[model samples]
Target: MDIIRIEQLEIFAYHGCNEEEKRDGQKFYVDANLYTDVMTPGLSDDLEDTVNYAKACKFINKFLTENRFDLIEAVAEQTTRALLKEFPKITKVDFTINKPNAPIKLPFGNVAVSVSREWHKAYLSIGSNIGDKEGYLNQAVDMLYDDENCKVGAISKFIQTKPYGPVEQDDFLNGCVEIETLYSPQELLKAVNAIEAAANRTREIHWGPRTLDVDIVLYDDEIVADSNLFIPHREMHKREFVLEPLVQIAPYAINPISKKTAEQLLDELRGQSENVNSGCAGCQGCAMRK
Candidate 1:
């Protein structure tokens, strides 16, 4: 990883809440550090392999001059997004917008806002047992792609699998998805839940049946233990239905601690039952893979 720092680039823009401030305009100072891997460019001495800071600065400057906003926060956010959009090499950014002359009469030094944003890798196990299963899955894929924050990376072929839990439910059609999203873990959870609800999925019976079932299987290299949700999905490894499809898309995704690949976990869980000893604390890969 490497850093490209742009320090205190001053610009005059008409972004403020107050009418007088908007009309009169004000000086805004922006500082940004673009984090990314520069090894490729450094090795080859090729501008194409890395972010060109000069070009990037020009983009940021032109963008602020063209777009109008009402807050420094908005300016910072928009600038960060614009920079990232222009340079795909950027991994994360720490951006700051400073307003040295706020309208208040008080003698405060300055008002500043800063935020960090990075791309997040997310894996989803999507399935539908009722209605047009493939259509439902494709529809979900389209919805995810339509979101600005979500970029569909890869998708595995749908697999026919016997239902888990009560076993009386219809045979499920399952598969895996790989995505790069700008949303946080909690935000992604809520978004997927919203998608599920929109598909008219019900929660009346546990594992009974559904129009669409989309589960968060992984998010980057994170491990979570929240009551509402868990990442590396609490049970994805042990369920052949989950592992089989996931392995197809990301066989090399290794568990952070256990260091097992999805393919290895699938091989281990071949003849096992889905619910047998699958718990969050003991999972070497997916919580379900314990």
Candidate 2:
């Protein structure tokens, strides 16, 4: 990653906690580091291949001047998000807002807030086994697409698969979704849970019928294991429904823990299923020929 630095770009903005400070705008200095690949521009010497610092500076100036916030922290956060969105080439940003005229009774040199933000690639597994199964899955996808912090990418074809777990249930419509999001793993979990709730998903019985089920299968090759959530989904490798559609869209996606690609995992799972008894305890769907 290459960095394009914007240092101490001064701007007068009305951003502060006090009313007087908002009324009498103060001078704010902004520093930003835009992270992107500059190799193409370096070799070609074409301005189009690189992020234009001039344009970026102007955008920062305009954004800061136009927006009114109560705190410099908000300024830094919003500015970082805006820069990432405005310049598609920049994948990450480190931003700082310096306020020298802060209303401190005692002498103070400066007050500043700095923030780092970047987009993360995440894979989500979506399924529905109840009424309006397809509708519920589509609604989940639409909810993710509607979120400004998330960019929905390739989606796998929906496939019907037998239910998992001991509880009897109807077949499920399962698929995977690829996305680039600004939310952290926990935040993304919250977002997906909200989407499921919107579809009237219930949790009465384990692996029982439900309107919608959204699971975070993978997030940027990250390994997360917590009480509430697990990345690479704890049982994804054993569940054909997850790997089947996941392979369709992200065949090369690697599991951080297993260090195996989606294709490799799926192949291994299928090979094991071939030798095992047809009647599997966990997921009968795997035993059924696709």
Query: Highest TM-score: which candidate?
Result: 2
> Which sections of candidate 2 miss by over 4 Å?
278-290
lDDT of 2 by residue, 1-290 (tens): 89999999999989988999889998999899999988999999999999999999999999999999997888998889888888999999999999998999998899999999999999999999899999998999999989989999999999999999898889999999999998989999999999999988889888889999999999998889899999979999999999999999999999999999999999999977875766555556755755
Q: Which stretches of candidate 1 lie over 4 Å from their true place?
A: 255-260, 271-290
TM-score of each: 0.84, 0.90
For model 1, residues 105-144, the per-residue Cα lDDT tens digits are 9889989999888888888999999999988888889899
Clashes of each: 4, 0
Model 2 scores a TM of: 0.90
Task: Give the best candidate by lDDT.
Answer: 2
Candidate 1 least-lDDT 10 residues: 273-282
